[model samples]
Target: MARQGRHGATRRQPKGVAFDRWLDRVVTVAVLTAMVIGLTAVAAHWLL
Candidate 1:
């Protein structure tokens, strides 16, 4: 197998790390918020 250069690995022809990090944070925050909301709903259902 041929090894690719760091830049070659990027799907975007001209790539920067800032986009990837921002995307990761956004996804993480969204998933966590969803989980919290789900748990809250379940708790309210059982407790109320």
Candidate 2:
């Protein structure tokens, strides 16, 4: 039997992991913003 030509390695695409990482970053930023706003409001009310 004869062998086939062009035995190159295939490239892999990690779209799922990339999307998950992006989603986590977005959620972390949103949570941090909410916490900062809540703390500022609480401090203002307590000082008044």
Top-lDDT candidate index: 2
For model 2, residues 1-48, the per-residue Cα lDDT tens digits are 988876569756676988989999999999999999999999999998
Question: When superposed on Cα atoms, how far off is each prediction in RMSD?
Answer: 5.7, 7.0
lDDT of 1 at 44: 100
- Where does candidate 1 clash, by residue pair? none
Which residue pairs of candidate 2 clash? none
Q: List model 1 lDDT by residue over 1-48, tens digit each.
A: 998867755575346688988999999999999999999999999999
Off by over 4 Å in 1: 1-14
Measured on C-alpha atoms, candidate 2 has an lDDT of 0.92
- Scored against the true structure, residue 8 in model 2 reaches a CA lDDT of 65
Instruction: Report the lDDT of model 2 for residue 27.
Output: 100
Q: Rate the local accuracy (lDDT) of all candidates.
A: 0.89, 0.92
